[model samples]
Target: MATTALPAPKSGSAVTVRRILAIIGVGFLVFFAFIEIVPFVLTVANSFKCLPAVQAAPQAFIPLPPFGISCQTETGSVRSATEMTDGIAFNPTTEGYQEVLRQNLGKWFVNTAVFAIWVTVLRLLFDSLAGYALARIKFPGNRLLFFIMLGTMMIPGVVLLIPRFIILKQLGMLNTYQGFILTLAADAFGVFLMKQFFESIPGEIEEAAQVDGASRLTMFFRIVLPMATPALTALAIFSFQGTWNNFMDALIILGGNPDLFNLPLGLALLRGAYGDTLRWHTFLAGSVITTLPLAIIFFVFQRYFVEGVSYSGLKG
Candidate 1:
């Protein structure tokens, strides 16, 4: 019996193949990044345009201010469809921001800030404690409680709105800030994240803390929690962003109380505030304002937002 040996792949061919794959991968990445960022860029640009300009040439993303003259100009106004695709430059205007801010928008801003900040702070404390308890403490029905939490995550939040509204009303918490914060204080995802990360920690650390006569609380706060900075930061970002942009919960819980309305809800109602017309520029302005804080925070902190790596210890 004769057996044939296959030819080995050439080094040049392998290198060519790798280069082609690398180019394709980078191309895909750039394409996706562009698409993701384009909406934000358009929002920022359109927020600075006149309503007519926004509706006329939305693709005109470049803003050109008539320096030392006036923001308003004939070039900025589109009189014909022919001009829509002719150029990308339009005179930038602050009218949208001015009008939106003038409509008692400051109050809505405060409301959104209050809701987002309080909820985020409460969630950090409650979720971390709950996570630590579940991850470390071996109480009766501990696994059962954790499983219940996981189950809750599977339930669509929209489905719970009716029940939540009824509960809040029965407790006289509806249309109240306290009720809003309490309801969102400890979400399951936060608990699950912290628990999984906590489990990754070496048990030897707890033993060492015990050897040093440190109480469980002391060891938890001083040792375990400190190491969980990565998870905590991630949790904080998610909580803050979610609460900041949360609309439905705010709407149902607050129940037409303008004082407690968040930015998202307020912005939605702004369409009707104008009556018989949609103000895209004002909407875009509000959107840009709403999106900026989260975007800035993420970009600045992303360098430090690393996955929680398990500690290797008790070595010889």
Candidate 2:
């Protein structure tokens, strides 16, 4: 039997198809990026604006009068922010920042920072340890335990709120920083994430450490842990951002005490003023402050975040 020869497609047509796909992909990316970024740009712009300016035209981003400079007339009388807020170029003010600072925002800032930092540290240490054990340890029911943990992640976090509240109440940890910290320190997702990353590491390295008379703890801390920086950094970012931005948990735990509120809860408190005088500027200023640290952390260590996510996806 004779087989007919198949002709390959022309190179020019293939190149044209590739170019069209690339252009379409780039267009979609740009469209989505704009959608995601516009809100952030508006938020940042509005944070610098006075209340009237923000309220009058929240979409305005450009500054007419120099930023941090008061809007004024030739007669030297101050102008209402609304006067220039209709246009793209509006007067920018530091009043929002000042008012926020004047509030008990300092205490909230400290509380948020403490919660985020402590939780991140604990998660990195505890999660990595748990993950490493689940990945490498040959104990009985290890897979069972790992699967059980993954099961917890499937349950809605809100479903656990009542139970968590009850547990904290029984432990007399409600409204206490220590209780809140301990409650958030170890989570199933972190364990699973770290476990996945740890499994991707070569076992030969740990064996070499053991052969050199290193204890399991020493080998983990000195050898394996160092190699898992990407995952650790990613975990740190996630833990800190989650803890820092957490409203429901913080509200449930610390709602009884305004003095102990984190930034999110505290910002929510700022909305209680009368309808006409809600202080939108102050609220926006607080929001910006809340987002700044997380943004900075993500920008600084974003490379590691990507690597950690990629490493965690690798299956043995």
Query: lDDT for every model?
Result: 0.78, 0.82
TM-score, per-candidate, Cα-based: 0.82, 0.83
| Cα lDDT of model 1 by residue, 37-145, tens digit | 8988888977877666676743787755551223344777433323322378766777778878977677888888888898888888788888988999889999999
lDDT of 2 by residue, 179-296 (tens): 7899999988889888877877789978887888999998889888889877787788778889999998888889888888999998886676435567777778888998898899
Q: Which parts of model 2 are misplaced by more than 4 Å? A: 1-29, 57-59, 64-67, 70-78, 82-86, 272-277, 307-316
Candidate 2 lDDT at 171 equals 94
- In model 2, what are the clashing residue pairs, if there are any? none
Residue-level error in angstroms, candidate 2, position 164: 0.8
Q: Could you tell me the lDDT of residue 131 within candidate 1?
A: 92
Error of 2 at 101 (Å): 2.0
